[model samples]
Target: MEHITSTPTAKAPAERFTGDVYLNMIEAPASPAHLASALVRFTPGARTNWHSHANGQILYITDGVGLVGTRDGNVVRVSAGQIVKCPPGEEHWHGGTDTTLMAHIAMVVGDAEGDGTTWLEPVTAEQYAHALSSQGGS
Candidate 1:
């Protein structure tokens, strides 16, 4: 077994996120392994751009309330202790609600080439508003 030290928290790029977002890299894929993980924290109204994994992704909510939106206009509210799964190549985004901070542990499975995620266009304001309305807020 290998012991891994904690890494510094990073501010998520504005191009791929809104509001304040930070990520702590927990584990990276080692040779012969294709799994990576991170602990991500989001301030109110912060969110990631639409993206998908080459293999798949799993998110375990650790604190506060959040929203997960899909390409088909489906927005779901997820809370602490809930687990959300995104199938391989399924376009989706996750983030904190307008009124609360959110954090989750994201586990991503990658392909042989270590390509885990493909990020798409940022979620538009209209889309976010529609999602919030659909769920009647977080």
Candidate 2:
């Protein structure tokens, strides 16, 4: 068995994230064949921008609560022990809710090169407002 080197924590881009967010590489293909995972953390009000992947992506919530948005105007609220998936090429974004710190294991599947993670625009205030309204602001 080979050992995987640990990398220092990287800062999330201000253009994409709103609050303190961090991630750590867990298992990579080099360490375990065909396996890759990341431990992600999002502070209150932190979230990702609209984006899509060529293959797909999965989010396994590990703590607090999280939220996800789809292009078709669907906002899903997820909590610990919940799992969320985004199909290939489906524009969406995920992150912490308004007043909670969210964390999850994000698994990016398929090709590492053309795997496709196209980052789109950030979640606008209007979009967030609409999402909250749709969910009764819960």
Candidate 3:
């Protein structure tokens, strides 16, 4: 097995996020292993744009609180140690809450040729407001 070195941290672009976010890639898909992983950290009120994956994504929350939302108005409030799963081709967005910081290790199942994410429009304040006000979890 070949050892993988640590990658430098990268700032998440504004075009794809609402606030400050950072990413530290843990692994990139290598031949025979088409899975990629990264540690993603988000500042308060920061989140990803609506997106989907070809083979789905898995997230293990590492710290603080956050929300995972879908276009269908299903919003899940998540905290440290939780795991959130997004199925293939299901558009969703995730990020920190209005008053909390959140960090998670995101693993995407796909090849290295691309980031494996199909990004769309950013989440608007109205969407975020509804998320914050909604009572998630049964």
Candidate 4:
């Protein structure tokens, strides 16, 4: 057994995030392990871009309130102690709400096909507005 050390927290890239988001690497799929995870924190109104995983993704909320949305324009509000699952190859985005900070442990599985996430364009203002509407602005 190995005692895992903490990795540096990094700001989510502008090309892949709409606002300030930070992530700390929890695991990175070492030998014999195909699983990787990160502890991600989002500032109020911050969110991720359109992206997908070849093997899906799992998010375990750890703090504050957030929202997860899909390409279909559906948005779901999530809070601490909640879980959000993204199906394989399904494009989606997630982040903090307009007035709440949010954090989650994001986990994913890797295969020989690719790394884990395929990032696309950032989520637009209109889309975020729709998300807020879906959440009733609360």
Candidate 5:
């Protein structure tokens, strides 16, 4: 077994997210394991753009409250210790609640060619507001 030291957290790009977000890359496909993982941190009201994995994605929430929404306009509440799964090629977005910070460990299986994800457009403010309302503004 190989022991890897922790690396500095990097700010997630604004082009792919809204509000403040940071990421600490854990295991990447370049390692012996052909999977990628990262610890993502989001400030209140922060969120990711629409994206999908070639295989699938698993999100293990580690702290605070959050929300995950699908292309069909279904937004669900996620709390600490909860896990959310996104099937292959399913477009989705996740983020912290308007009043709480959130963090999660994201795991994704990469394809043979090392291509794992396709990033699409950012989620609109209208969509986010609608999601929050769906959750009763919690």
Candidate 6:
């Protein structure tokens, strides 16, 4: 058991998200175990694009409000201390609520090679709008 070498925090790329987002990788398999965690912060109205994971992922809200949506037509509003899970290969997205900042600790189940996650397309404005409207917008 040893402390993993921390990597520099990086901006989440537009390819994987819309608006401004930052990520701080906390632990990775290379750092020690099968655990992989990152502190993800989203600016107001910022969120991830539609994507899926090979081994699934877990997200624990840490600050502000988070909006999580799935391909199954479910959209959830999660607050600090709340936790959400995405099943393997299920397309989903999560990010800050409109007009609010949001943050969460994201953990992806690692593969044998230590790489996990298969990111897909960015969620369109139409989709986001539909989600909010369906949920009655908080």
CA lDDT of each candidate?
0.89, 0.79, 0.91, 0.90, 0.92, 0.86
Worst 10 residues of 5 by lDDT: 27-36
Candidate 5 all-Cα RMSD: 1.4
In model 1, pairs of residues that clash are: none
Candidate 4 clashes: the total is: 0
**For model 1, what is the error of residue 6's alpha carbon versus the real structure, in angstroms, after optimal superposition?**
3.0
lDDT of 4: 0.90
**Model 1: residues >4 Å from true position, as ranges?**
none
Point to the candidate with the largest TM-score.
5
lDDT of 1 at 56: 82
lDDT of 2 by residue, 16-86 (tens): 66678897878654422345678889987778888887777899999998788899988888899999988
Choose the strongest candidate by lDDT: 5
Report the lDDT tens digits of candidate 6 across residue range 84-136.
98888888999887778899999986766774777788888888888777777
Give the clashing pairs for model 3.
none
Off by over 4 Å in 4: none
Clashing pairs in 2: none
**Regions of model 3 farther than 4 Å from truth:** 1-6, 136-138
Candidate 6 residue pairs in clash (backbone atoms < 3 Å): none
Each prediction's RMSD over C-alphas, in Å, is 1.3, 2.7, 2.5, 1.4, 1.4, 2.3
RMSD of candidate 1 to the truth, in angstroms, is 1.3
TM-score on alpha carbons, each prediction:
0.93, 0.84, 0.91, 0.93, 0.94, 0.88
**Of the pair 2 and 3, which is ahead by lDDT?**
3
TM-score of 4: 0.93
- The runs of at least 3 residues in candidate 5 whose Cα sits more than 4 Å from the true structure, single-residue gaps closed, are none
